[model samples]
Target: MGNSNQKLQEEKYENVMKKFKLKESLQHTQLGMVRIYNLKDDNNYSIFEFHKTATTSEEAKLMLTHYKNRKCYNNDHLTQIFFISEQHSQILCQDQTQFIIIGEFFYNNIQNEMKNYIQKNNSFPEARLWQITLQIVNACTYLETNGRNHGEIKSKNIYIHPDQSVKLIEYNFIYGSMNGYQKALLLNDFQYLAPELLKEVKAKKSSPNIDFIKGDVFALGLTLLELASLNSCEQYYDWISKEVHTDKIIKANDLLLQKGYSTLFTNLIYQMISDVDIRPRFSDLKEVLSHFENQINNNVDFYSKYQMRQSNQFNIYNSVYTQQYQRPGQINQAQSIYLPNGSY
Candidate 1:
C-alpha cells in the first residue's frame, strides 16, 4: 500500500511539473539555477529556484521537514520552499544523480539595495536603518523562539523589498550546523563570525562547542554596524583582518562611534559584539530597541528635527553636540542647546 501511494504521489508531481513551463534560466545561485516559472497567466508570474547538487540533499530534507512540521516557518520573512518533481528536474536539465530543491524567488538582496540606496541617496537614513534592523531582529527572534539558530546572518543573505522590509535566505548553513555536517567556513563568512567562533575555525575543530545563537548575535552586530556606517562587509573585514581578535570588537565599536552614531546605538552595538559571557540575548536586545523606538516616536519635535538633519548639509556635531566651536577671543560664543537624552 505504501509503495502504491508513493507511485501515485510521484505521478501527481510529474503532472504538476508538466504544467509549469520554464520561461528562462534566470541566474545561478549558491545552490542552483533560479528560473522564471511561467504559470500561463499573462498577469501572474512566479519564480522557482532549482538546486541540482547532491550536496544539498541534507539541506533539502531539512527544508522539507520544516515545511511539513513547522507551520510558523511559513511567515513572510522567510522564503517558502516548493517541492520539485522529476519532470521539473528534467526540464531544468539537472543531473539525474543530484537532488533538486526549488524555492520562491527573491527580487534583490540587502547588499544590492544598500548599493542602490547609497548611489541614489548618498547614505541610508537612520529611520530606515532602524526599520531594517527591527525586521531582521524580529525574524531572528522568531527563529530563537522556535529553538533554531540562523547560524548565518549577513547582508548578502538578507533580501529586501522596496517597502523597506527584509526576508532572510540561505538556511542551508543552519541546517548543516544543526546536523553536525562538518562544514568549512568560506572567507566571506569569517567577517561576520564572532571572535570565539573564528578561533574555533582557526583551530580546525570540526564541531566546536560554541553557542550558535551568540555567534549569530555577533554577526548581527557586525551587519548592523556595516549598515550604520554605510560600509560594505568586505570593507569592514579588510580593516578587522589586520587586527588581533581582542582588538576586533574594540575597533568595530570605535569605527561605529566615529561614524557619528548615537552613544545609545553604538553602546548597543558594543554589547551585541561583546564576548559570549557578556553578549546581550535577543530578548534583552529587543527591549533596548523598543526603548529607542519609543523615544524616537514619542518626541515629535525631536523626530522631525532628526529627519530634517539627515541631509549631508547638516554636520554630525550639529545634531549630536550641544556646544558650538568657539574662536579665540570671541566675546559672544554660540550657546549650547540641550539635546534629547543629553548628548546621545
Candidate 2:
C-alpha cells in the first residue's frame, strides 16, 4: 500500500532469513497462506512472528511498528524484534475476481525460548520457570490496564525473554469481556482456565457481560500451582501433559475439607477455576506470591505454600540460571534479577 510499509516487510523478512541461515522463500503459503523464515544473525530479531492482515505492506508496517514500539510493555528498555508484516504481492491469491495479498509469517522465538527452558532445566531446573509463569499475570495486568483482555492467556501466547522479562504477543484474540459475548466465547484450553470460562461451550458458554478477565486471574492461579507442583517433584521432566495428577479443582470445595493438602491445594485449584465470584485476582495472587518468596528466602511457614522450598529435593534447591544468550564478544554485566514476587 505504501512504499515505507513495503520496505519494512521486505527488510523484516530478509532479516529473519539471514539470522537463521535459511533461504528466503519468494513464494509460499498456498492460496491465502504465507511463508515464515528464521534468521541466525547479529539481530536475532523478534523470536518469530505471524503475518498480519492489512490492505498493503505499508499498512502492515504501520501496525507492526506501533506494536513493536509499545511503551507499556516494558519493551521500551529492550532491543526490538519485528514480528509481523503484510504478505507479498506475488503470493496474494483469492477468488479470481479478487486477488489480495494478506500477510507474511516468521519463525518466532517463543517456541525456542520454551525449548531452552525445557532444555537447560528439564532433568532438574531452577525456579526461573515458575517465575516466568508469574510474569504472565503482570502481562495480563498490563493488558487490562489498557482496557483490553487477552482472550487467550495460554502459555504459548506468552514470550519469555532471556532477560527474565516477558512480552506478550498475539493480540489477534485480545478482546473486552463485552466483546467475548458478541462472539461465542471459547477459553484457550491449557486446563488452566477458570471453571466458568473453561465450561464446555457445547453445553454452556460465558456471557460476554460477565467479567472474563478473571479467566486470566484463574490461569495465573493454575500456573502458580503447576509450577509449585513441578518444583516439588524433584525434576521438571517428571511433569508433563501426561503427568497431570490432580482434578479435584473442578469438584466441590467440600471435597477439599475432607482431605488435607490433597484437599487444600485442590480447593485452591477449584477457587481458581470453578468459583469466579470468589476467584482470586492478580493483585491478590501477587500478595500471596510475595509472601511465598519471603517464606522461601526466610524459611517462614506459609499458611498457603504447599511447601517452603522443596524438601529432600536436590533439584529446586540446587539449580541456578544458565546463560542462554551470549553475544560472541559481549561483556558481562553484573545486575540483580527479580521476579514479580521481588525475588531473584
Candidate 3:
C-alpha cells in the first residue's frame, strides 16, 4: 500500500513540473538548484527544489501548511509563494523525496550586488547602507508584530526589487526548522547565527524561553557589518561561533568606527551583533533607525543651505557637497552632505 501511494505522489509532482518549461539554472542555493520556469501564462516563476530527507512526512505536511499560511502576510517585503508540492519518495532515485516550492522571479539579491562592490573594492555609502537596513528592519518588525519570526535573515535571502526596495525571501524556519534537531543544523550558518543560537545547538536543546526575534537581529547585524566593511564575515565565523564558549566580547563597534561609519549607526550595529540577551528588539531598532534617517536628512538640508550662503568662498565644498545623490526608489536621495573620509 505504501509503495502504491508513493508512486501516486511522485506522478502528481511530475505532472506539476510538466506545466512549466525550464528557463535557466540560476544558482546552487541551500534549498537546492534555483531555476526559473516559464508557465503556460507566459509568466516566469522562481522554483526551489530540495529534499525532505531531513524531515518526516508529518513535518513536511506542517511545512506545507506553513508555506500556504504565508498568504496571511500581505506585506510588500515578503516574497509571495506561487506553488508548492511534495513527494513521499525519491522519484529520481535520489537520497530522499523532493519538495518543490515556487515564487515570483527576482532578478538580483543583496549577496550578488555586494559582490560587485567587493570586487570593485568600494563600500556602500552610509546613507545607502542605512536605507537597506531600515527596509529589512521594517520587514522583521512586521513579522514579529504579526506573531512570527524569520530565523534566516541574510544577504542571500534579501531580494532587490526593480524599484530598489528590498524583499526578503527564503523563510528558513517556516520550512527548514520545523523540528528541533533540524532547526539546530539549519541555524548552523555561523556568519549570521546568533551566539545564543550556537549555545543552544551545542547544548543539543533549545532554551524553553529563547527569544528567536533577537536572534534575527544579531544575524542582520552581522550582515550590516559585511556591508560596512565591504568584506565577508566568513573569516570570523569560527571566532563568532566560539564566542558562546568564552567570556570575550566581539568588538563590532570598533570595526565600524574604523570603516568611518557614524557613531549612531555604528553603535546600533554593535548592539545588534552583541549578545542575544542585550540585542535590541526589532521595534527598538526601527525607532533608532528612523531617528537616524531624520538626522541625516536634516544635516543634508542644513549643509545645502550653508553651502549656498558661502557659494563664492567655498566653491569646492559647494561643488562637492551640494550635488544630489539618488538612493533606491523608497526615498529621494539628498543633496551633497559631508561624509567623513570621502565617503561621498
Report the Cα RMSD per candidate.
8.8, 13.3, 10.3
Please give the CA lDDT of all the candidate structures: 0.55, 0.40, 0.59
For model 3, what is the error of residue 194's alpha carbon versus the real structure, in angstroms, after optimal superposition?
2.3
lDDT of 2 by residue, 1-344 (tens): 55576677678766545545333444321112333344445333333332434455555555555554442344221223434344444335621111122222333334355455455664212234334544555556556666655554444445545454555543432111223222333432233434444343334544434565777666554543444332221122111222222233222222222222222233334445435665556555555555445433453322233322233212322333242111112111211122223332
lDDT of residue 32 for candidate 2: 22
Please say which candidate is ahead in TM-score: 2 or 3: 3
Q: By TM-score, who's the top model here?
A: 1
lDDT of 3 at 309: 24
Q: Is candidate 2 or candidate 3 better by lDDT?
A: 3
Q: Which ten residues in a row have the lowest lDDT in candidate 3?
A: 324-333
Worst 10 residues of 1 by lDDT: 327-336
lDDT of 3 at 65: 75
Where does model 1 exceed 4 Å of error? 1-23, 26-30, 38-45, 51-67, 70-72, 82-102, 173-191, 235-260, 290-344
Encode model 3's per-residue lDDT on 106-131: one tens digit a residue.
66788888888888888667766767
| Highest lDDT model number | 3
Ten contiguous residues minimizing lDDT sum, candidate 2: 326-335
Give the C-alpha miss distance for residue 162 in model 2, angstroms.
4.3
Ranking by lDDT: 3, 1, 2
